[model samples]
Target: MKKVVLAYGPRGFGNYTFDTETLEFSGSPDTRSGPLIIPGFIDIHTHGAFGIDFMSATVDEMRDLCCELSKVGYEGFLPTTVTAPVAQVRQALARLPDDPMILGFHLEGPFISPRYPGAQPQGDIVDPPVGVSEWDPILDDSRLKVITLAPERPGGGDLIRRLSNRNVKVSIGHTEATYTQCREAFAMGARHTTHTFNAMRPLHHREPGAVGFALTENDVFTELIYDRHHVAREAAEVLLRCKPESRVLAISDSTMAAGVPSGTHLKMWGLDCHVSEGTVRLADGTLAGSAITLLDAFRNLKEDFGWSTAVNACCINPRIALGLSTTEARTYLELDPDLNIVARYDRKK
Candidate 1:
């Protein structure tokens, strides 16, 4: 292995150094003429990018998507699943590529609430089954990292405990659960919330729904899509202020339309999604998944909030959220003051 050191920042704020080979950081400022190094972005929630959807992608297609994501500096990612038939979801999982970039799988549907199925195929949405035996094929897979579901649905709390007992992270999302219901779910073993305020119930003063619960609860980690379109800058600022730095996860939630031209039209989730004006929308004008990548979210957070918030949300929080170990080789994105990825240093390479 090569002895590589990456340096960034100026005086006062202190210099950040990364040991590419060991994937460790040294805070002591050093006068080294090297590019700024940030942890390789790990996107915990992403459907697809580069005009490929994980739900219908072949192994080669998924590998192609992985290559495309590496160009944008994603060292690790979770190939998230959308709400689809149980059989279809199983097929998708079986077909996932064994790329080094693929940390695991994020099962994001089927057991979600139809009432808050934002852009999800409502026809396929259903309540959790009474037992985990019915989904043994999925639950048995050790690669299953996170599963997003509505805890207010039938057998939802039981499912949460079952999945948590197996060491699989459960996230609350696409629900109409109020504060009390969310608390109950948390007590049952759900420790995360998907996309924060998007598909769940709104934060009412009297009700303090899922969004409210996620904010006030320190133990619960919240995933925030920093695509300026899915979440406004002002709202993101408010989230940064309200949530603890360690508990906020910055995710892309990007779909197939990302990395394509604005005029591109793609079919996803049985709907015609058009990518334009930095946003993705269906024919009926409902906002679909994001067109931004984790890199974009990192830049947005840094620009909209600050470096501290961006690093915590994009880098440190993701690994903590998934309970992943970084003892293996890691990749680092060497960025400039403008947040441009000028170069990359991969320890494995």
Candidate 2:
């Protein structure tokens, strides 16, 4: 029998020296220098990875995504659903894997502001059905982690309150609500904003729409895409300045084009699409979604926005917002003496 030697630290592995076959730990720590290591990334909102769209994925396809994500250092994710028929949504939910790393499900639409529907099909938009006493059965076995809705829709505030009471996190998105309407929803328990500025009304001094309320509220967590295209670098800086440390959660909002290299065709929201110059758009000029991943978003936030640490965006803050236990092993990178990646093992491994 052999052993492995690993040096662990706060962010990630400091050094790892080992014998592969024998599993023996040996030699001085491999000291190489590199970018600071961070915990394996977690994505709160992502529709798909590789070429498999979540809407169309079978249970086996989701398992494939989990394996693929492991290679890229993702520890967990929430499979997000776009606007679709209720029956179709239920069907997709039925096929998800029971893996713990597949944390839960995020319903991005079906009840949203029709005016700011973005890529969601206009046909799918609808007022919440009356007297739907329980959504639990419809969601299958997956925990309903988060739901995005337009607070201005009929009974929208009531829906937020209902979900909140059931311990589900509520987010406002794809909305055209005025400031007062957003604030009212917040009072009733909408605690997050979905991909903040993308499918919501822009911030204005006069209107103070969803973005405005998100900036001002200390309790509301806002998900930012951080692909540089979703929110401009300068504007992102401004948002960072306005929101509190506990209220900012970075999400990939990634589409099926993720993980695949540039120049791949993928179907999105029932339309053929391609990734061009980093943005995924449809033939009709509709901005489909992002092609980037959570790790890429973290890198962009650090490299472009001058963020000093990934903890707030990546770990501590998001866990707190979601009421999740902080017991998971947090990973990060550290440069060795020679500035290289030192593969270290930790308890979670």
Candidate 3:
């Protein structure tokens, strides 16, 4: 491991100490110089990493992905699913592993808008008020924690209400809904926004679309991808300025290509995508998903915000969003004085 340079705590660098032998980290700004230690992150909205795609990977492969994520800094995460046919989606959902690190499952599509499909295949997008017989099995899955949809399509409000009543987190995304429509959805139990500002209506000055509502609504949780490409730093500043730190969290929205070598091409959702410059994009250059982990987002956030703020965004906030105890993370990511990852220790066996 590299020698000491800085420590990231409430007070910043040089306030902590680490013993590589004992692998213990202690802090407060006056302790002997050592590595920067932080709680392992919980990503609520990641697709896959290390060449694994949650949409198609077997349970065993997903477990392998979990072990790989642990090496960086993640303690738990949702194996998010993309839009697909009902049978296909259920088959994918059925593959979720019952691992402690697998927090839950996120149904990211099949009930979203076609107008703002983003990288989601337009053909697979389904309108609101999903039929009960087919979707009931999906909704009944105890591990189904979140579902993102546009609340303006047919049966949108009803679908939002149904999911909310079942304690499923309803996030607004991929819609051209007006401010009033979004507010109505929020009233119906939509409390979050998916990958805020991407694949959502732009925040028009007068209209104040879904993006505007997400930023201004104090109770609305916003998930941001801070890979410097999905969302620019200035936009993040605006979001942070408008919402409380607790209501703002970070997500990777990463694709299988995230941890793979750059320039690698793969067929994602029946489209050609290539990883380049840490981004997976289509032939026309539309972003498929990010190519970064929560650790990468944490580093980017700390560059703009302080270390304390970054920890909240990357570690604490996402867990809180899932109704999990913020104190549950025991895995520690140890970074050298320069904050480079040196090692990680999982205190919880």
Candidate 4:
């Protein structure tokens, strides 16, 4: 067997040295310099990667995507769904992979506003019927983690209550809800916002839409797409300022266009989308989604907003939002002078 010396610690410290041959650790007692190490990025909202679209991907395809993502430092993610026929949505869910790394499914639409539908297909939008029980089967599964809905829609408040009672995270997004409506939804148990400041109402002194509510409310965990295109550098800094630590989650909101080099048109929710200038837009010039992954977003946050480190945008706060142990959470890794992954371990596990 080959013996190798491994360095381990947060922020690329060589303080805790380990011999990989026997899995025994020791103190290096010397400072090492090389690549900056960070915890495996967790993306709670991602649709697909490496040319696979989650909405139509088979179980094997989803697993393939997860395996590819692992190479890029993504440890886990949610398979996001767009507005589609109920039958198609159910079929997609039925075909999901059972791997724990897949985490769960984030249903992004089908119950959102038609006016600000963004990249979602307009034909697939539907209003929830009174006493609708169709979503119960989908939501009953342990793998369904979060659902995004417009709070002002018909029966949306009740839906939020029911989903919250079931312990499923309900996020407000893709809507035109007024301030009062947002407040009522928060009172009823909406605890998160989807891609704050995009595809939702903007914050105005008089209107105080979802963005305003998210900024003011203490309990809501707001997800910011830090791709720079989604939110400007100054705007992102302002959001981080208003949102309390542990209450902010930086998400990718990535689409199938991620990881692909550039200048490629990909199909998103049945619409043709092209990546240009680091933003994914539909053929008709509507903003579709993001072309960057969570890792890229973290780097952008650090480079643009001086966010201290990638850990500040990637691991620490997201873990807290997911109700994981922050003290024990792995945020970054220490690299030896060679810039290799020395020894790796998670803070929680």
Model 1 misplaced regions, further than 4 Å: 1-13, 16-27, 30-34, 325-329
Worst 10 contiguous positions by lDDT, candidate 4: 1-10
lDDT of 1 by residue, 65-160 (tens): 999999998989999999988889999999987888999999999899999998999998878878555577886789999999999998898889
Write down the TM-score for model 4.
0.86
Name the lDDT value of residue 285 in candidate 3: 96
Model 4 Cα lDDT, one tens digit per residue, 158-268: 888888897789999999998899989989988899999999999898999988988988788888888877788888777778877667788888888888767887877
> RMSD in angstroms, all models?
2.9, 4.9, 3.2, 4.1
The C-alpha lDDT values of all candidates are 0.84, 0.74, 0.83, 0.75
In order of appearance, the predictions have TM-scores of: 0.92, 0.85, 0.90, 0.86
Residue 97 displacement (Å), model 3: 2.1
* lDDT of model 3 at position 59: 86
lDDT tens digits by residue: candidate 3, 240-311: 999998888889998898789988999887889999998999999999989999988998988888776788
Which candidate should be chosen as best, given lDDT against the real structure? 1
Better of 2 and 3 by lDDT: 3
Candidates sorted by TM-score, best first: 1, 3, 4, 2
